[model samples]
Target: MRKNKLSFQERAGSLQEECLCFCEEASREAMFQAPIELPEGFVIDPAEAVTNVTWNADSLSCVSERCFIETGPEPDEIAVQFAVRLQGTVTLLVSVSPVRNQYGQGNGAVSVIHSAEIDQVVYYSDEPDDCPDFSDIRIENLVVVPPFYGSPLSVTGTIVLVPEPDQRSYVFTANSGDSTVSVIDTEVNTLVSNISLSDIPTDLGVTLDKAYTYVLHGNANLVSIINNETLTVTQTTPLAGAPRKIQFETGGEFAYILAGGSSIYEINISSQTITNTFTVSPAADDFALDPNGQFFYTTNSGIWVVNKYDIKTGQLIDRLSNLETPNVIETPLIGDFAYLENGELRPNVVSVIDLTTFSKSSQINRLFDGLITIVFSDDGTRAFFLEPFPENLTVVDTAQHTMITTASLPGASDIAVTPDNQYIYAAQPDDNTVTVYRTSDYTAVSVIPVGTGPAAIAM
Candidate 1:
């Protein structure tokens, strides 16, 4: 007898009392089963499907037992399609002729026939709705292409999904010689306020929550915590020695301070007390924390080495030696690699280290002379480095390990890229101005005058 194939077609509508049935002719001793797969942001109840299953989101339980909905990353406004395939097989019990068990009982074993692709189901999100009703939403050939993951660093870059806006973005500049921090409204391209401090601010570290900005005073042996919203100093916590650099953990619960030239101090932000301290040989010129907050990378200027230390125990986990006066270090948002700017006294090269192996992966050379500072795009695709001697900004592609282009900025002392990766801001202390360039075209967008000696910028 010929087996009849099963098929169904329906228009897009609300999933209400929808049932898809699969039937096939079989003998009395035969059984059949069909398994289904779902897309990324979807789910199906096992009770409704009568089989093993996985769900995209748990909140969709209130919607329908058989329905799969969008609950993962934000979907593009344009139509997206998902393909589903169904696999089916038959099982049967067979008994050997005249075979008896030792206990005088006939024995039989169950066997399954090879499964084959039986059906194809395609789902289309062609309509504009947060939760569109899927038609005959059953499990089978599951195909899904998620929307873009993050915003492009440049205009020509790939599209990415960005986080929802909550708080306004502002630029924080640490004036090393002026003993003050200038706050600039990035949207307006103007200076909004100048925060006064007792000592010169050497570096700036913003909390993950963006609630507080920590300013390290190079001469005062203190870290000033500034409330970002009110733009005022909330508290000042004294350290063991003058802090060379400050790095915050992802949770903002504690901060790691490289102080007193050779010791690392971990401070609890809420209690404003030193919780732990670890000492190292010689002082580190710069350092950066990994994304997981498990370890940190510090550069020893004297010995020309980069040491990795465990954040909890302060134990040296790994070291990349044989470097040339590693002066500045930066890690991208992903934290998979570290980019170290070797000083001009040594070769003009940026040592790239793979965080996983803690080894020098490659070197980006011929970037510029007299390397002042370096900053990365939010997505970690491009790096912007400042060379004050030549007064130029060099942009390097992180993936290709090559120089992309160089732009001229007179007296470019420091460089910073916005969180949205839309613009690049370079501080020219000689000109006493900050020049903004569009990331897409590297063209000058605007210039705003700041206080004297604008040395560092934080976003």
Candidate 2:
């Protein structure tokens, strides 16, 4: 049966409220009176003690609108030294007049200056009796952009921009603690679907070929293979114990489940069941598969590298121990080497594993207090970590294996990298906010609110 695919679109900007305007204008006029009779308490300061004096006025014809001015004793010639300023009680004045021609033709003469210095000014209007015209005007515009709001849940799991036929990116999130998956319309930045699952899902791995998604249920002790097309649970394969991490092989025919002890469940996609189980020496919390499917790395009580067997033999080829505490093991896409982030204190480390030798060649430590999640960039040039508890995401340059940038997450428990490598979404379990950051400059763009205890983030 053909499936009806929903279109997902990317949002241009976040949601916000409408902006307000700010245009206003005040009128003008001219007048001359008794200095606007001062009130009982309006006594001016002594002229000798004044440091500054200012005035403004509007004028028309013979009348001049004057603003009150007071200043300390100064030179009589400096009466025009009043300062210029703005206030609700102050205004400017304009004066106009026509002057008479010297050849006995009558015209008006006009002069303008600070009202306080009007006595020092002179007007030579040719037509002294003629009155010209004058007018006054005042003008004001408003500004517009709104505020951004997000969900309340700490974003755990991943967000993928699955391009739909309609040109939208279908956004999805996997919550480890909530044990629920949220589907969002990227274009609208709105939640459209929330899929409920079993106990805390630690890992989410999706495959488009078979239209199935494998979820490692950390507390449920099972691997849920969900049908992506139908958005329904197709099968739940029982594992040894808590399956904290799971990944699908490149061929898309088999899946690997890493559980509590030193065992890993190898399930067959055809039968939708666990066909064989491989128990390596030490136990592991997570595992990663080499893109080539020749070798798989699991973080046991230490760390172990196991070779793929022919069938249900459940035999391991090579394993390494006494290494650093390993959390998530991933193989960078650009090179054959693998990267591991140990989520332990004191000797917290990240190691570079040579796939061919199955040995740790180089390692860096104390990069952070705890690094439980590590994600490589799309091009495999950089790697990211979700340091739990003291919530923060740190990015490292893969070539140098050195720390590059760090972002504070506060109650952050997990992080997810978008397929495009544009944003890193971090989940804060206590704060219940998913912070989105730009990967290039590592600037915080937005904080998305979500439900309580967001435990995982993926994309």
How many residue pairs clash (N, CA or C atoms closer than 3 angstroms) in each of the candidate models, in the order given? 7, 50
Every model's TM-score: 0.61, 0.56
Give lDDT tens digits, candidate 1, residues 1-459: 011111222212322345322212211111223222223333322222222222122122111112232211122111112222222221212111222345535433212222322222222122323232222222333222222345211101110111222576677878876888888888789888777777798778777667778888878898888778657676778877888777777667988888976888888887767899988765777788886778987887788888888888888888877777777898876658888877546446788888888887898857546577777777788888777665367788988778877777777767778777778887776776788989788789899887778877777
Instruction: Point to the candidate with the largest lDDT.
Output: 1
| Candidate 2 per-residue lDDT over residues 184-279, each given as its tens digit | 444455555556665566667655253666777777787776665434556767776887666677677887777885677888877887777887
Off by over 4 Å in 1: 1-166, 270-272, 343-346, 365-367
- C-alpha RMSD in Å of predicted model 1 compared with the true structure: 19.2
Let me know the TM-score candidate 2 reaches against the reference structure.
0.56
